[model samples]
Target chain A: MASNWEEFYSSHPQPANLSKNEDLLRDFTARHLNGDTRVVLVTSGGTTVPLEHNTVRFVDNFSAGTRGSASTEYFLDHGYAVVFMHRVKSLQPFSRHFTGQKFLNMLDLIETKDGTSVTVTSENIPKIADVLRKYKSALANGKLLELSFTTVYEYLWLLRSACQILAPLKEKCILYLAAAVSDFYIPPNEMSVHKIASTKPQTISLQLVPKILAPLVSLWVPNAFVVSFKLETNKDLLIDKAREALNKYKHKLVIANMLQNYRQKVTLVTQQSSYVIELTTEQSRIGEEIEMYIVKNIVDKHEEFIADRSGRS
Target chain B: MASNWEEFYSSHPQPANLSKNEDLLRDFTARHLNGDTRVVLVTSGGTTVPLEHNTVRFVDNFSAGTRGSASTEYFLDHGYAVVFMHRVKSLQPFSRHFTGQKFLNMLDLIETKDGTSVTVTSENIPKIADVLRKYKSALANGKLLELSFTTVYEYLWLLRSACQILAPLKEKCILYLAAAVSDFYIPPNEMSVHKIASTKPQTISLQLVPKILAPLVSLWVPNAFVVSFKLETNKDLLIDKAREALNKYKHKLVIANMLQNYRQKVTLVTQQSSYVIELTTEQSRIGEEIEMYIVKNIVDKHEEFIADRSGRS
Candidate 1:
């Protein structure tokens, strides 16, 4: 396992497009901070761990980024400037509302002598328009900035870079670490340069991924409200693990959930107390997402944290 | 390693949706065979090997289903009925033309007092309409059957089931195996029942997955035209490995490709000879895909194989 964050960054080469993305991010942050806008960094989707340097195959976490993508809209609605970092090809805000064959199903095609035309079906227009309006508004105001990464190494590098930029903003920044990051990864020196041959039985050894949250909480953005998610399959261990993470990282919150029922229920675990937030059957049937409630609670908690810090100063 | 295919099948449970999908496949094949139409089974995308039965994380091959999805369209245009079996959410024939945010980017949203509407931009209408027409025609003619799988076990089960239904047709059946299947997997008994906790360094032991191609060639569809893909990162081993597979399995063909330049070049290897197919920069820039050539060659070979068999009989 890599014990030092600096060493880990040095050992792994930066992603080819990191500098370009960093420049864009820097400008976005500068504009938001200058306006005295509270910025929320929402990390979405899963990070991949390549088995080979060339990466013919990799280990992936199962995340469509629904939680983070859905939450981004709520943050924007609540007047927070949003930095949306996600996995490439994973779901994104606004785009998440139209996936699979949904967009195609909603449109009608008309052919004429001149050419063909496509239009959204009459019944679906109002619904699609609402989403489009929010999406366009965010883009127009430059309140939303999108960045993407594919591999675990890229994710870590980008996360640190984001924290470095957000750090100076102090309590005005909120880091919503919702991405399902890989806990284990093959070291750079240990990974095969080429695709591993399958002619014989192979054993893959993975080292524990260093807890970057440790540095991010204690050093990078100490005053920022940091919220992390703890997803577990075993119900018995869910709250305990979330509490443990809170104690160890000394972060503001750990949203604990079981994999099977995460969509319906989640527990907000903090240093002081724990509370469950769940959706009723009726609410879920009517297409009410739990992220709305989750974001509302986080926003309230963040307000209190900021107020407490200001009073002390 | 599982040397016996039957034993391997017995050890793993069938996919939960296999029976439902098989019913659809059987009806589609039976209907097409009665019409004397040649049927091609195109397996696309990558298979996932779950580390846990609950499956929070999995080992996945690097494939966007580009080869299989692109080739499916070619096969359809050539008057062959297509069975597109792919990883869930990977890609589809018509949908491949619009992925990520491309579909949304091509549209213009209009708002009014009554509601809002979405229309394909005038410039993009002709292109979208052309694809839509092809998609609608395939459905109307019942020439396309879509089935999906996520895990390696599910893929293996569905592949065997598809072969069983296609076996009686003999020379009319084609198996285009383009899916990036995993070489190693954890057996059901060995897989964790819950999500694997990542509190410490972990060692994951994987057994060699049984070579299903052995039975698929010798037993399941002995007379069918089978074309498998060999994707390698090392240029030196690409052709040699393809040849080795051809020699061992005695399959009709092995399409060999190096990971870096796969879109531009590929070598088709047979027992008798090997030939390289390549696309120039000008051709690629004009939107020419290598799959078009690849499918054409496969179709010609399948025709020759049928002719030779008929002559012998």
Candidate 2:
């Protein structure tokens, strides 16, 4: 069946049905082109494990894709072509379709189940409804939503494919590995099962599946400017671990975050220096911090490093 | 001027213009309460920091109050009166309102947004939309959303006020600190004006402010069930750091998360045992795991601990 499935897809040669918001990539690349288009891949949300045919176990996270989507938006605002590989239900609109009257319609249904009722309305209701309508209008117009992905394997597969697409654009491409890919997956054989019955095995144990995505930095994505992330909770040892990951992965930069508080805590670790990022509070107005900061720091460094290596800026 | 402002609000209490949604809080409380309503305080969303008179900086979080609201739902589902202290833009609903047409309306919206626009004559959309509508609807209700504060100082101030409200209910009350707070804040006197003229700071220097909310666990919320979160990024040193924080703050449990991969990686570090959480790619189905695994783990433990300590079931 697997062989047949592969052959069918191979023979069909279908366009990958990718969806997600990658305005950051487009914007980032447009502003600072390294003689090529910069490609960014952002993975998000969590995957599920099938416990049974009817009942499945969800491998999930607390991330609503705020960080990933926010970062993705920043990238787009700056001119980079982004390939956002994400799981389902991320708060981010996979395409502009995630907004509009439909969303508010959900709200309306919640208030008054029957469409004819039209019971719930107030000073704020219209305002809220307007916001929803605007969102839906945006989605209808395809202005907000972009990019897509559904599963862990699917995310990985498309991400690898995106890397391949960006390979030819290497001199100008940048790979920002920000998605939190799952560290494990169900053994392929159990994909169709309904549930892992206790009677089957009192202690069902499995082996760790080596992460195939991380190695991509050193292996396939070597030509592109790569930035990896290392999150540590220890305020004392976060930088050290970040440096270690940078050294091991040989990526240009490592974003280190102290797990103490996540409102806005990201530290950029490079070969020579570590810059702590104090993200603007929720109260602050939106500006180009993530994009501006990275461009000022990483992209410029990439240019300088390349110039020093190849004797051109 | 500050004192005058305080006096104004004190003499003329800010009229609670309770919206229809706010009214739902009462319904939820009544429907959910099991025994004597001892004490309940629920914190939601990101806080806002007042800058100028009308233009205040919002130093909030990326949290949409999904977790907070879900927990609230669980409490209400189990019959508990709750005092919800939330931030702006919370996405949870106060109650579950589902009807025939209302359910179809939700489906139409989902389909319209997805662009499939395929009509589902079946009750699938209503059933699903009814289930998914809680987060946003609950938030629309008149929950206590604390505004003001750019730095952690202001957040701490608002938190203190909330604590004061919950003080009388402290004996059997539970204080759920689910809001994502900024650990750092700008000094009130050090507030600066935004300048688009210069792209750089003339003399960029700032001093660290003391954490205002930390004292609440030991001081104001002494007997309250305090559950604090410690977000970290390192895998190797997670428990050690979490344990250290637990010792310092002496809270009940520290919900620790790795910095960048927080959405996917979580760890529950108690005084004795530690449980590491890894999210799989299961799409929206993962909410169940969040409740069953992480939420249940803590609640069950807390219940057991409380029962053992108080010698009650």
Candidate 3:
């Protein structure tokens, strides 16, 4: 049975450092509310469900924070302040483009008797410069705030804290929830204190994770533009699920993606209409991101949303 | 019931790029066999068990590949050719030092009208230089071979391929199985092709993953020295579990650790002798690592094992 969101929060303890993060969130949200700029809270990456209290084993949703991280960059370019809440080690904006050995490989060492100097190889200087300039600019202007979480418990706690802190922004705030949060989790009460033994067959019972969107849309930030994502392996269930979520939650949009081609294509589903955003084979080959178009469409729609509400008032 | 290792191999299709990885492994092993250096195949990081064939969700072990990555660097220092098999995005030997924003933060952009030059800041130069020099030297000497896997299926297949390739090394080979391998897994036939519905409570049944160490010890690379790791959240269970594994697999050693303080302390368990390798509080506070001590002990023991066998022959 699905648990009550209120009861869920009450039953589960608040994650460590929730208040501390909330302080940062409040400060960031307050700073943006004073400005004419729009604010976006982009929740990225996947949430983990620990099978054991100390977490020797866990169930994880598959996400590298690609959509959310890329979308944050686009949002920043569109003149919005972004709070990037992501999994601890998942990809982040600016740095996501160059990962693994690619980062180190771009560098060269120049050693002299005086000292050693590390320089970006000439061939890779342009790309590094572009990314670095943007990264430095964002930090310099205080346009980006980063927060991280690992487990589902921590994610939910942080999300609610962010909502309360962002509540003052109301219509000016946007919640872009691209995180692949676990829909089922082993609650703390049932989790083993130690690592589960390997000697026997294991049967793991997972309870339904209470739908936080119910409370979030109605109680937390009703006037804010909220966007959710639905990922599937089977394409047939994609649109129906996306539309269902939109109708049920009365949210602004649902981005539907198939697991196989998520980076290349996604569907933007709204209450009024549904549209497809895809990268052509050549565009994909030449390194075009579907998120570029996705973010553009959403930004345009968000303007319409803000205007419509102001007209109603 | 536990499935036989041979049947398990036959049941699951080979991982993609297995043949390609095997070819690389063959070449690396052949090159090392021609040389006088001992080769250690160090498996690091955690393995995943996909809940769906399309892999929207997976069961994962808790490991950042710290022990394995750190050990690989130490093995290189010990004059051993190293095969570093790890989880795709987990920590690596050299690059592990700088992760997340730390890498970007260490860099400075020097832009003139002529062009832009990216340089490591003065404070970070010494550390980056040290790691880079070692990294370059290892690659230049062809003493390091890296292979990566994301899932348990891929790890197992690659491991067996590596064993077959390294068998010719005989007593000169060391299998340092440090990866936090999953003990239970849902069979491929039982996994969902689509994302599992989250509308209700879910019960996942996992069977015991076949013990590959049995075949690894008896059938493949029988003459090679092998070491396995056992981690428990409870310290009381640590030594017993390690000894049990040693007795069962008849492998050369088992490194036992408590998950809570693994980096600070580890116990080396062998048939006739068991000892603890620990970092003092002062050492840990000073950023000293226990892997340095662990690797030194293992390298010394490895030499003794090789000499003992040669003397008997």
lDDT of each: 0.90, 0.49, 0.91
Q: Which of the two candidates, 1 or 2, achieves a greater DockQ against the reference?
A: 1
lDDT of model 1 at position A255: 95
lDDT of 1 by residue, A1-313 (tens): 4357777788889989888888988898888776668999999999999999899989999898999999999999999999999998888998788776577667777878976787888898788778877887898889999999999899999999889887878899999999999999999888999999897777889887888999999988998999999999999989889988998889999999988988999999999999999999999999999999999999999999989999999
Question: In terms of docking quality, how is candidate 3 classified?
Answer: high
Per-candidate TM-score against the hidden true structure = 0.97, 0.44, 0.98
Residue B88 lDDT in candidate 3: 90
Fnat of all models, as shown = 0.77, 0.00, 0.82
- The full ranking of all candidates by DockQ, starting with the best, is 3, 1, 2
* Ordering by lDDT: 3, 1, 2
Per-residue lDDT of candidate 2, residues A104-164 (tens digit): 3433333344532222223334434443444455444333324555445566556656665
Q: Residue A91 in candidate 2 has what lDDT?
A: 42
Estimate the lDDT of model 3. Answer: 0.91
List the candidate numbers ranked by TM-score, top first: 3, 1, 2
The model with the greater DockQ, 1 or 3, is 3
lDDT of 3 by residue, A1-313 (tens): 2449888888779987988998898788778888689999999999999999888999999999999999999999899899999999999999898777778788898899998988889999888899899889889988999999999989999999998889899888899999999999887889899999888899999999899998899989988999999998888899999999998899989999999999988998989888999899999998888888988998898898889989999
Docking class of 1: medium
Worst 10 residues of 2 chain A by lDDT: A196-205
- Deviation (Å) of A232 in candidate 2: 39
Quote the positional error of residue B128 for candidate 2 in Å: 5.0
Q: How far in Å is the alpha carbon of A123 misplaced in model 3?
A: 0.7
